[model samples]
Target: VFELGDSVNQIDTKNESKNKSAIELLKVPKTVKNLKDIKKRKALANLEINSLAKLKALYLSLAENC
Candidate 1:
Protein backbone atom coordinates (compact mmCIF):
# COMPACT_ATOMS: atom_id res chain seq x y z
CA VAL A 1 0.00 0.00 0.00
CA PHE A 2 1.36 3.52 -0.90
CA GLU A 3 1.10 6.37 1.60
CA LEU A 4 -0.81 9.50 0.47
CA GLY A 5 1.60 11.80 2.34
CA ASP A 6 4.56 10.33 0.49
CA SER A 7 2.84 10.90 -2.85
CA VAL A 8 2.12 14.53 -2.00
CA ASN A 9 5.77 15.14 -1.18
CA GLN A 10 6.82 13.59 -4.49
CA ILE A 11 4.41 15.83 -6.41
CA ASP A 12 5.76 18.95 -4.69
CA THR A 13 9.32 17.98 -5.51
CA LYS A 14 8.44 17.38 -9.16
CA ASN A 15 7.06 20.94 -9.46
CA GLU A 16 10.31 22.41 -8.09
CA SER A 17 12.44 21.85 -11.17
CA LYS A 18 15.71 23.69 -11.85
CA ASN A 19 14.89 24.39 -15.47
CA LYS A 20 12.44 27.32 -15.65
CA SER A 21 11.64 29.58 -18.57
CA ALA A 22 12.44 33.25 -17.88
CA ILE A 23 11.89 36.08 -20.31
CA GLU A 24 13.55 39.44 -19.66
CA LEU A 25 12.22 42.68 -21.02
CA LEU A 26 14.85 45.07 -22.34
CA LYS A 27 14.32 48.77 -22.85
CA VAL A 28 14.33 50.18 -26.37
CA PRO A 29 17.71 51.51 -27.47
CA LYS A 30 17.25 55.22 -27.92
CA THR A 31 20.78 56.39 -27.08
CA VAL A 32 24.43 55.27 -27.02
CA LYS A 33 24.03 54.10 -23.42
CA ASN A 34 22.22 50.98 -24.71
CA LEU A 35 25.04 49.91 -27.02
CA LYS A 36 26.39 47.38 -24.55
CA ASP A 37 22.96 45.80 -24.11
CA ILE A 38 22.60 45.50 -27.89
CA LYS A 39 25.94 43.72 -28.13
CA LYS A 40 24.96 41.33 -25.33
CA ARG A 41 21.73 40.35 -27.11
CA LYS A 42 23.68 39.69 -30.33
CA ALA A 43 26.17 37.50 -28.47
CA LEU A 44 23.42 35.40 -26.90
CA ALA A 45 21.66 35.03 -30.25
CA ASN A 46 24.91 33.83 -31.80
CA LEU A 47 25.10 31.19 -29.06
CA GLU A 48 21.54 30.13 -30.05
CA ILE A 49 20.06 30.74 -26.64
CA ASN A 50 17.53 33.51 -27.38
CA SER A 51 17.14 32.85 -31.08
CA LEU A 52 16.57 29.94 -33.46
CA ALA A 53 19.44 28.24 -35.25
CA LYS A 54 19.69 28.39 -39.03
CA LEU A 55 18.58 25.40 -41.12
CA LYS A 56 21.20 23.32 -42.94
CA ALA A 57 20.51 20.17 -45.00
CA LEU A 58 16.83 20.43 -43.99
CA TYR A 59 17.61 20.41 -40.27
CA LEU A 60 18.18 23.12 -37.67
CA SER A 61 21.91 23.54 -37.08
CA LEU A 62 23.47 25.00 -33.93
CA ALA A 63 27.07 24.90 -35.18
CA GLU A 64 28.81 28.24 -35.14
CA ASN A 65 30.19 29.59 -38.38
CA CYS A 66 33.94 29.95 -38.59
Candidate 2:
Protein backbone atom coordinates (compact mmCIF):
# COMPACT_ATOMS: atom_id res chain seq x y z
CA VAL A 1 0.00 0.00 0.00
CA PHE A 2 2.79 2.46 0.81
CA GLU A 3 4.56 1.74 -2.48
CA LEU A 4 1.32 2.26 -4.38
CA GLY A 5 0.79 5.59 -2.63
CA ASP A 6 4.33 6.70 -3.51
CA SER A 7 3.77 5.84 -7.18
CA VAL A 8 0.57 7.86 -7.26
CA ASN A 9 2.27 10.82 -5.65
CA GLN A 10 5.07 10.72 -8.20
CA ILE A 11 2.61 10.68 -11.08
CA ASP A 12 0.74 13.62 -9.60
CA THR A 13 3.95 15.56 -9.26
CA LYS A 14 4.91 14.92 -12.86
CA ASN A 15 1.50 16.00 -14.07
CA GLU A 16 1.69 19.15 -11.97
CA SER A 17 5.05 20.11 -13.44
CA LYS A 18 3.77 19.54 -16.98
CA ASN A 19 0.68 21.66 -16.30
CA LYS A 20 2.81 24.46 -14.89
CA SER A 21 5.07 24.48 -17.91
CA ALA A 22 2.11 24.54 -20.27
CA ILE A 23 0.56 27.46 -18.41
CA GLU A 24 3.82 29.35 -18.53
CA LEU A 25 4.09 28.77 -22.25
CA LEU A 26 0.56 30.10 -22.81
CA LYS A 27 1.20 33.19 -20.70
CA VAL A 28 4.27 34.27 -22.65
CA PRO A 29 2.39 35.02 -25.86
CA LYS A 30 -0.37 36.87 -23.98
CA THR A 31 2.22 38.97 -22.23
CA VAL A 32 3.89 39.83 -25.53
CA LYS A 33 0.55 40.72 -27.09
CA ASN A 34 -0.31 42.98 -24.17
CA LEU A 35 2.99 44.77 -24.55
CA LYS A 36 2.33 45.27 -28.24
CA ASP A 37 -1.12 46.68 -27.49
CA ILE A 38 0.32 49.10 -24.96
CA LYS A 39 2.90 50.34 -27.46
CA LYS A 40 0.23 50.84 -30.15
CA ARG A 41 -1.97 52.81 -27.74
CA LYS A 42 0.93 55.03 -26.76
CA ALA A 43 1.77 55.72 -30.41
CA LEU A 44 -1.84 56.58 -31.22
CA ALA A 45 -2.02 58.90 -28.23
CA ASN A 46 1.11 60.68 -29.36
CA LEU A 47 -0.33 61.18 -32.83
CA GLU A 48 -3.52 62.63 -31.36
CA ILE A 49 -1.53 65.00 -29.18
CA ASN A 50 0.48 66.21 -32.14
CA SER A 51 -2.67 66.81 -34.15
CA LEU A 52 -4.23 68.77 -31.32
CA ALA A 53 -1.14 70.88 -30.98
CA LYS A 54 -1.19 71.66 -34.69
CA LEU A 55 -4.84 72.63 -34.57
CA LYS A 56 -4.21 74.87 -31.61
CA ALA A 57 -1.38 76.59 -33.41
CA LEU A 58 -3.53 77.15 -36.48
CA TYR A 59 -6.32 78.59 -34.38
CA LEU A 60 -3.92 80.99 -32.68
CA SER A 61 -2.56 82.17 -36.01
CA LEU A 62 -6.06 82.80 -37.35
CA ALA A 63 -7.07 84.69 -34.21
CA GLU A 64 -3.97 86.86 -34.47
CA ASN A 65 -4.72 87.70 -38.07
CA CYS A 66 -8.34 88.54 -37.28
Best by lDDT: 2
Estimate TM-scores for all models: 0.29, 0.52
User: Which tens-of-lDDT digit does each residue in 1-66 have in candidate 1?
Assistant: 123333433433332321121122244544677767756764654444322212221121222432
Instruction: Give the candidate number with the greatest TM-score.
Output: 2
Per-residue lDDT tens digits for candidate 2, residues 6-54, read 3434544544554555445445544765777656655655565455455
Where does candidate 1 clash, by residue pair? none
Error of 1 at 2 (Å): 36
| Candidate 1 local Cα displacement, residue 26, angstroms | 14
Candidate 1 yields a Cα-based lDDT of: 0.35
List the pairs of residues colliding in candidate 2.
none
Give the poorly placed runs of model 1, Cα more than 4 Å off.
1-30, 49-66
Reference-based TM-score, model 2 = 0.52
